[model samples]
Target: MNTSEYGKVAAHTLKLRVEGMDCGACALKIESALKRLPGVSDINVNFGTEMLALNHDAGRTSRQVIEDKIRNLGYTPRPAAAEIAIPIDTGRQEDRPWWQTRKSRLVLITAALLAVAFGVAWVAPSLSFYAYVAAALVGLVPIARRALAGAMSGTPFSIETLMSVAAAGAITIGAAEEAAVVIFLFAVGELLENVAAGRARAGIKALIGLVPRVAQIEQDGEIRQVPVEQLRVGDVAVVRPGDRVPSDGEIIEGLSELDEAPVTGESVPLSKTVGALVYAGSINGNGTLRISITKTAADNTIARIIHLVENAQASKAPTARFIDNFAAYYTPASMAAAVLIIVVPPLIFGADWETWIYRGLATLLIACPCALVISTPAAIASGLAAGARRVLLVKGGAALETLGKITAVAFDKTGTLTVGKPEVTDVAAIEGDEDDMLAKAAAVEQGSSHPLGLAIIAAARSRGLAIPQTFGGASAVPGKAVVARLRDGFVSVGSPRHASELNLLPDTLSDQVQKLEGEGKTVVIVATKDLALGLLALRDEPRPDAAAGIRDLKALGLQTIMLTGDNRRTGQAIANVLGLDVRAELLPDAKLDAIAQLKAHGPVAMVGDGINDAPALAASSVGIAMGGGTDVALETADAALLSNRVGGVAELVVLARATLSNIRQNIVIALGLKAIFLMTTLLGISSLWMAILADTGATVLVTANALRLLRVRPTTAASPGESA
Candidate 1:
């Protein structure tokens, strides 16, 4: 399944960790350079936050290409940096230390001073305009310094420059009070936006902070602490309980569970027996272990997540790119419309110049399109936050949007549809009683280490069947079965076909065994020397939520398909039980191909939980990996199931549908309000106060409406009846 097929246009997205962003001016400079790049449609740079978002066409540019451009623009890119800093200590002040984050304090001070002047103007009506003019002249010092600095450097505009222009224009019109009010309010909003952006950056900061500060390594059986950055490849590190793993590596010794939720978003503690791979940033839960560093910090999982998010932000969706293109011309077009509304109406209809000029100004304010600019990102941020709570980490809005449109969901059967482990499914006795059959099988297979043997032993334990203490010298006969001298006689348990080769006579249960085998269930034959005693059927249990999940998908109008490495009969049987429409059987490669085939029907999503499924998951429109499964699966999937519930896939779809609906509604409301404001402004019926109210009010409305998703609850009721 090609993700690019979901939309008509595909562009390359690159994430670059930016350095040296200290203020809005620095952010603006980087934004300008990025926008100058050939295919970049939009660039949003927050200097108070060290991040750059870019969207370009893949065919025209690559990740490295963009990094080169950023380098040329005098900024450092993430991948090529020698050392990456993990954000430590979240909720700290932005742009600088707490004392240095004085933007808000300065703005408040300036506003208070201006308020005093405004009070004087109000007390003396005659001085109302002049007193505020004096205040504007006082405020112009900082604004002029900023504008002159930009002008001297060849850059013509800054936020301060814009503020000076608006202020100068206000003073010329004897609206000094209005000018002061505008500048003060603008400063306050800028300060607030800086604070909000700071808070958003904190999430990533906490994530980066996970990069271990130090490592404890063992050399010659002696342990020593070393800076994590100084650690190199092949270094043997000792990780104590409750400590974060210093680097990505494999466990060499010890066994205990580890909490990797911080990195993988899987809240459950994963068992870490010897030889299990441990990742950097995962907390060791009561386990002392040694690991050889396999990857550098740059290649670590946490670093990669940071890179993914940064790149995702830089990248633009097709819709977003289209909007940007529209805006380039749209803003100028709106300006012309406002001019025409003022000039042509007064010239042709003999309207008062004041009335028409006010009409033009109203049109200008109405045409700023703040509602359109702010709604989408705010909604996305809120939705992403809500998803993170459930442990569903959507890297960006595009993937979140794609998940909702999934019309067909294809699953990799082994670890996704069924539990990764096998267990005894059915037990039937012929001439021998059920108890005797199970006992004989367990006694003979007690020493075997095969998965089948372990399964049988587990089944016997579950049924309270005991193996003889001295089932003397049980031996596995390679190609045949397991045999041992039980108290009664030499008992054997193996495949029925293998049992036949051992000269065991078929009993009445043989027919039943054949019938069960035909249903794709594995039948293990239990026998004494002469005749077949009974049959034990074994199969992996379908996950408790698998069927319900499939049912939910079908209810949402999504076609469900199951792909497996099992045989046709086994696949068909499981698909039948789950009411799935499509079942493909074969190798992992076949599953990948099957996913590709399914995509021709519509946008396809592949779900899986094993390393083998990684490629297919990556190949799909959206890869949904079971979180509790393989690391490869989790890293490759677009979204992960935190609870590892198959039903969570359905729930995700429901969430996506809700989010999309909300976005559409938001767009409608914003656009509708903007249209009405435009008509009112053209008719000379709107005031600046009304324009501000409409613009800000529409923003608040859209924001609140988008946030409705925060209160979204998965329907307690299931999707209406639809077949999988």
Candidate 2:
């Protein structure tokens, strides 16, 4: 059945049949297809169901064209079950004159008139006056309409339209040629603003385009290519080399290296074997694997990212909200003021209309606030793109703004500051070499999925030590130890307390365990023949950059704190290295409360792994989750470190502050320049050319300055060995 069967508004629906998708990437590709279309306002796609839903503007773009785009992206096009018009505020271009329909067109016409006026002045100096007046009129059309409408709408006054009116008033009095120059310049400024805004949205569009389409499903014991959405939970799917994982699921069979860089910002490929959980959007390297779906297409990692970013863009920041309202009213007030400057002065002071009118035209040229309107949004967009490039995904301008003001940074101990997985840092043997002990440990723990056990096996493999055959009668005791047969004797391995409980405690092993524990490492004792032989100490070490990064935060005047589930000694060890002021331990809920306590001091930002730390991340003024940690953390945190590096926190803070500072500077320059010119025009001392210079010049300056962020590279490196 078609999407119309679902009773949605068909006019707003875009049905896209896509191709070349072998996983959840297809859903993302479809969503982007519809979203980028002219009239399509919103879109959602289900990879497992092979379906898409969209809300569109039926007038400006067609569902057919959108569907065609989906087909172009290599997907089969099918109508959705329903289509509906969403309440999106898209006003008609007809409200303003045709000339102002787009900034580019306005700029072109303004340029043409300026050229004509200059040519006239060059060829016949006498009629240059009329040529100038004509040029000013060309520029005035857009400014006059905008200002008048804003005034009638009773909106807050904007500086651009006001400047435009002032310049135009000056030209009308007796300097018509000069008035034209001012209007043309203002139009040029508006054009530049439009260009910068367009560039800002580019990176976001590129990100949305990363989702792939289609999946190769294994159904009825036969491998066949089918729509990703058609693969339900428990359905098995085959993932080939270089293919993106279709859904969040567990590997049922086979082994492969998965590149999770796109989704998690980690450049390393993770080894996935049977029973290992894999996330969607991660690239499957060489080797094929059969996976059993665990999460639906909509609930997958990439889908959550799309949903979060899209909604974030829709939400306006305080700065944008203020400007929007201010522009609405400011335009018309400026227009009215320009008119008064011309007529009121003549009537009240008994001066000639020609002279006063010229003054009014000058005022009009200085009134348009295009530069001011475009300044902050463009900067915000650039900043967001910069963050994205570094594998950091900041929700929107609001989040970035909050990031700049964060005074205290709270970190979750596990995953955020330390690797979530345990690793063997020290291995010792009482009566044998290290390799022999590790080989036995690996063989015994090979089948176990416990974090500590995995660490032992991984360490042995890294050292190229071959593990012995699987041990018989293997038994795992909860929170205690694992006992199994070894070549020499029965071997038991677990925490020191557990070894003592089993009467396998040894004197040398106890001394080593205490020594390691004093170094803040977790110790597991290995006992043989009812006697502990050695101690294996493992600790999730602090990220190499964590210490220096914390120091950087302090340099920026931000306080740093560390919170973890580790014991006080372990927590304090990490805290001391990083110079954190607060170190809390032993409970997840306590982390959340600690975040609250930090907030009492000032605005606090909680840096964490999105998974177990969601509560604390949610409680902070701003939440920054490490990329690759968890899907929930990515969604819950206001900002995500796609680089999955702790040092990004420091860079993010610095970048945010820079962006805010640049925007403020631009606003001051734009408004300050206009004010100076406005005063000159009222005294009949400002020429039309001067007004044009001020308006367009300010626009170029601000736009160029806003682009300064493009050069503001991330100060954090993706890897410890990489340069920042």
Residue 227 lDDT in candidate 1: 83
Assess every candidate by TM-score. Answer: 0.76, 0.73
Per-residue lDDT, model 2, residue 83, is: 23
Per-residue lDDT over 1-724 for candidate 2, one digit per residue giving the tens place of the 0 to 100 score: 1235677444554544232221222343345445555656657553322335566766667766765565554345544322211111123222234345466576788889889889999999998888878787767776665555433333224333455555555554565655665566656655554454444444544554444557778767798887555557887888999888887789999999999877766678989899898887778999999999886666666666655554454444568557756754665677788889878867988988887776666666677665566556656756666666556678877888888888888888778788777889998888678888888877778788888889998999999998877556678877887878866777777888987777776676777778788778888887775566677889888887788788778878888888777778888866876778656564867777788888988889998877777787888999998855366556667998866788889888877887788778878887898898898878877777787666677777776776677567656423222111
Candidate 1 residue pairs in backbone clash: 12-58, 15-311, 53-314, 54-314, 86-208, 87-208, 87-209
lDDT of 1 by residue, 1-724 (tens): 1126667446654544564343334454456555655666656663423666566776666667667655544345553233653533233345365335555665765687688887887788788788778777776666566556544443343444445654675576566776666556554544544454455455555667777789999878899999877778888998989899988888988887888877655667999887788878889888788898887666666666555555444444444445545654665576678679768978998988766765565556556554565455545544554554444556666777788787799888888888878888887887668876887787777777887888888888888987775445887777677888877778878788887776674656567777787766888888877877878898877898788888888888898888777788878878887889655556767777888888887788888884667778887898888754234544667777645778878777777777777777767876788788777766656654355445445656666675566555553118421111
Which window of ten consecutive residues has the lowest lDDT sum in model 2? 81-90
The backbone clash count of each candidate, in order, is: 7, 89
* Candidate 2 segments whose C-alpha is farther than 4 A from its true place: 1-172, 205-314, 323-357, 442-449, 461-472, 476-480, 486-488, 498-507, 577-579, 586-589, 682-684, 717-724
Best-fitting candidate, measured by lDDT?
2
Error of 1 at 667 (Å): 2.3
- lDDT, candidate 1, at 346: 80
**Global lDDT scores for all candidate models:** 0.67, 0.69
State how far residue 530 of model 1 sits from its true place (Å).
2.6
